[model samples]
Target chain A: GAGVSQSPRYKVAKRGQDVALRCDPISGHVSLFWYQQALGQGPEFLTYFQNEAQLDKSGLPSDRFFAERPEGSVSTLKIQRTQQEDSAVYLCASSPGGGTGDTQYFGPGTRLTVL
Target chain B: QQPVQSPQAVILREGEDAVINCSSSKALYSVHWYRQKHGEAPVFLMILLKGGEQKGHEKISASFNEKKQQSSLYLTASQLSYSGTYFCGTETDYKLSFGAGTTVTVRA
Candidate 1:
């Protein structure tokens, strides 16, 4: 792909519904990141992956949120028993380098609306 | 942790200059600059990793002062295309934190 790609541009889910957001990073990008952005706020970090290894997940708001990159390219962010607070845009980003400050190319985010 | 950014919002006439700042409470390993247009994904502008190193891309430039735990982005002779929210994200100790962005509007 030319750039990072995210699936299900917009999703509406009732309370307690489970939803999954998928991301396909640019070819050969070794680093991946997930973020959540609420209305009128900057994106907040959720988790990070270097290839298939998840290095940091401390930013995930709750244990109900889980992410995985099975083959080091396609990633999924799953929210179990969604709540109103989970209504936010989820962004996925990728980078060629795993080192400090390498530019992360972002994908068009998935807007998740939880009722 | 969130880095502190100054001037929550700014409006500028095209061709003018402006500066946005970011300061962290702890030591920083690197500082990143990104621009996000309304309804679009953010695009990386530059990264400042070495202490006292400065980098520029087009009319946008950024600097990092490691000793001060701060970084600044400078927009010289701004263009209408430069109108967007600017965010400063930092990396330190396995943590990557982004500041509350500075919203910038460049008018004709």
Candidate 2:
């Protein structure tokens, strides 16, 4: 695709259930980031991937959140034992390798609602 | 910590101008501006990396002040298409912190 693409545009799961979200970044781009945005709040960094390596994940809220980019192209974020507080929009963004001067393109994001 | 954006919401008519402000409590190395429409992800508008440089995307522009730890986005001749939420992300200490956002409504 021409831009970052995210799967499961919307998801609703009962509390304690597990859910997985996927993202396909732009081809050849070397940087990928995951963010979580709660209602009426700014997007908070969750994790960052440089190719197949998960470089930074200091922003992950807890141990229940995990993300992986095995091939460096497609990535998945998994949440275990979902809680009502986990409801939020999960956004995926990608930028070319380099630095802050580069532009990061974002996907529509997945709106997850844990019931 | 994240930055703070003023004027949580603004309403304007076509050809009007609007200004949105973002302030941080810490020194900044760069500031990034993005606009997000309803139900869509954010799109980059511009970036100000220096203390005195200004950037423009068409009639939309932004300015940064490294000393004051603040940045402002300017919109000239506002168009209906400009109605959306604007977010300012500040880069400092190797991390990017974003403001809550400012929503602008441009009417015909």
Candidate 3:
């Protein structure tokens, strides 16, 4: 089976421009999560979705960030007015069950560079 | 808050062993281990619940101590493939707080 995947492996954007990153979770996965990883640091939680409902978004850094899982499969993370500080790798993960304890499978990630 | 990992980095030789530890200040519901290489996504290694049961996968294993809010990852007879940054995620609720990460460099 295909694992979780993300599009636009690399993206370079000008500061203040808006950018969107896409993620395709494993088929039939009920839980999806997004994380942001800075260079030489651990990934920080961004948001999470259970099916079509986003269960949590507390990890989102600011109002400029938005995410959606419309059909409970594919998800997108959008950043408005990107800043140089927003330049980092965005990772998506999914698990078979909705439980938080479930093991999550990760995607290759999309590296966003804001200039 | 994020957990703390000991020994920011370690260098080892094939067939040697090493231990990576993770400690959290808050009560944890679960602890997850992941290994990530440069320019790649993190790969899940194992998960240990609050029960403190020790689990193993191949030559790698882990122990979770609920009482101490700490976990230890053991790499026995380490392989070159084990060379990567290891992160421990502590789950107090639905979200996981990951540590700074411990880099393991294994030489042949």
Best model per DockQ:
3
Ranking by TM-score: 3, 1, 2
Which residue pairs does candidate 2 place in steric collision? none
Candidate closer to the true structure by DockQ (higher is better), 1 or 2:
1
> How do all models score by TM-score?
0.96, 0.96, 0.98
Ranking of candidates on DockQ, top first? 3, 1, 2
By TM-score, the better pick of 2 and 3 is 3
Candidate 3, residues A64-108, lDDT tens digits: the string is 999999999999999999999999999999999988688888999
**What TM-score does the predicted chain A of each candidate obtain versus native chain A?**
0.98, 0.96, 0.99
Which portions of model 1 show Cα errors greater than 4 Å?
A: none
Error of 2 at B67 (Å): 1.2
| Candidate 2 lDDT over residue span A1-115, tens digit each | 5889999999999999999999999999998989998887778889888889888899999999999999889999999999999999999999887465566788999999999
Docking class of 2: medium
Candidate 1 lDDT tens digits, B39-69: 7888889888966899999988998999999
| Candidate 2, position B98, lDDT | 82
Misplaced by over 4 Å in model 3 are none
* Full-model lDDT, candidate 2: 0.90
- Candidate 1 docking classification: medium
